[model samples]
Target: MSTEQPMAMRQIVVSSAEDIRVERVPWPDAPGEHEVLVRSRLVGICGSDTHACAGKHPFIALPYRPGHEVVGVVGAVGPGVSDLAEGDRVVLEPNLVCGKCRQCRDGRYNICRELAVFGCQSVGAMADAFVIPRDRLHRVPDGVSDELAALVEPLATPVHAVRRAGVGPGSRVAVLGAGPIGLLCLVAARAAGAEVVVVTDVLKNKLERAQRLGADAALDAAAPDLVDQARRALGGGADEGADVVLDCVSGQSSMTQAIELVDKGGTVMVVGIAAGPTTIPLHLVQDREIAVIGSLMYVHDDVRRAIELLAGGAVAAEDLVTATFPLERAAEAFAASIAPDQLKVLVSVAGPG
Candidate 1:
């Protein structure tokens, strides 16, 4: 008789606010049709993950596995999967959508009616190994390092927002909030050829970092005249605001500022997730003809462009990733990510393949 034990792996689960622990779980079964088994290498802690841990995120529930931004190596491929093979480095898109939905059929699967994120709503890639559909994996370029690959997921969101806002050569842009997403928006806007980009944040350190990352102006969000400051910095008068205002904070104050800071007929892209319902200036929106667009997660083309930006040196990973911890210390990593000074915190899952 032959006997063998099933493989086990460590997975991080957040049960409630400030409650996170690692549990040993059985390894995922072999990939079925069009599936691929991926061995996670690095995972980035997202702001939503922290919000869920703090019981603030409206979408993500408690007691969920927490790794959506992941870079991994393919371990095995199932039948019908031809493009990717074992040992290929890939990044997770994490969006699980229903193909029959209107949005999906229209090629906007990021907001599918039945959209469920892998880490937020289902089992995530925080484990040593995970099985996901082949279509959800984007092969990382050879020149991209593991750290840079891990950033593709986060960067994709900003890229999507910038594209939707129609940022282009000689465009004037203002980003509200200098966190990871905000800084990324700055980078994406600049890459899209924005003539001037102004970034705002309550944290002085974050503002300084933004200036170093090519922002034309980094203003203090708490300044009483922040609106005027941002407008002036964008080379516009008080009446002529920025061409596009990206509200990366998505709070009441930031959203209001976004509406006021955008030029007439310009766009106000809500790139961040609001913790709760907040009121906006509906009257101003109507009179100015401002398009208050809500940008959700990104589509596949956005991911491809994000990868290109990272691989082409448009987005520098070293400037963003501030701290890293081993998988065993994932809780510590989550803690570090919430630190006011930290930009991006990563958990080291497995070594580079």
Candidate 2:
């Protein structure tokens, strides 16, 4: 066995109900069997982390490290691990799927019955070190910025959503919300060759950022004529409304609005999580035959392709990076992610480890 390192570091912690703490944690051990120990470098905060902290997330189990969208370096590999070794710079793909599930057998492992996301279901990268299955990692290319590498996980999500929405050249799309995920959805939709992509948000600052990020039009959701403006921007009536609508805001209002404004037969992709059930107008669905697709986390190929997009400069991952905090100051970082006017916040556990 290799000798263990000392000087254990702080682990950003979440106990329950908006409580955020940091505690000294031991360096992770070498992998066991098919696992590898990653010295985590950059772990970005997701909306789910905030919700999880507030006890609003349904999937969370407390006293957990809460960052799943992670990037790191391979420090040790366990027995049976091959093709990768120590010192490899990598980013993690967090989905752990049950190979025997129906969805897995059909190759749609994204929907596996026993699917488990890294931060949500296991020890996460918010800590200084963590062990994960070796296969969960993907190598980050040489030119890709650490900021971009950190976003590959979330980027893949919106990419997967847009793909399922069937967006491509000339598609008219609307992305609801201007938060991190919504903004990423806009970038992905635009990259998909959409002729026009509009983004909506209640905050003007976020809307302005969305405009700067290449949204063809940014609308204020609180406007009295919000729907009218969106429809008019798409060219004038319901028939001219967006060919696809991505609902990045999980509230009922935004959800219903996405369904209401798309053209007949258009697709509506929900990229956000709903706190509770909200009824969609069955009449609108029956009339338009709109395809409502609920996108979960990204699949394997989605993560790979997202990395390709980042490495090739197609996706503006770094633009999405707003703040970086040392792992010791992780509580402050998580609090900042909840504040307005920020995009992506990252906790740095290990420096390019």
Model 1 lDDT tens row, 1-353: 11122468889898875678888899788899999988899999999999998889999888899899999988888999999988899999999999898999999999999999999999898878899999999999998999999999999999999999999999999999999999999999999999999999999999999999999999999899999888889987768998999999999999989988999999999999999998999999999999999899899999999999999998778899999999888888888998997999999885321
Please name the candidate that would achieve the greatest lDDT relative to the true structure: 1
C-alpha local distance difference test of each model: 0.91, 0.83
Segments of candidate 2 deviating more than 4 angstroms: 1-3, 7-9, 236-238, 351-353
Across residues 156-238, which tens digit of lDDT does each residue of candidate 2 receive? 99999998889999998999999989988987887788888889999988999888888878999988788778987766465
The C-alpha RMSD of each candidate to the native structure, in angstroms, is 2.6, 2.2
Candidate 2 lDDT (Cα, whole model)? 0.83
lDDT of 2 at 247: 94
RMSD of candidate 1 to true structure, Å: 2.6
Weakest 10 consecutive residues of candidate 2 by summed lDDT: 1-10
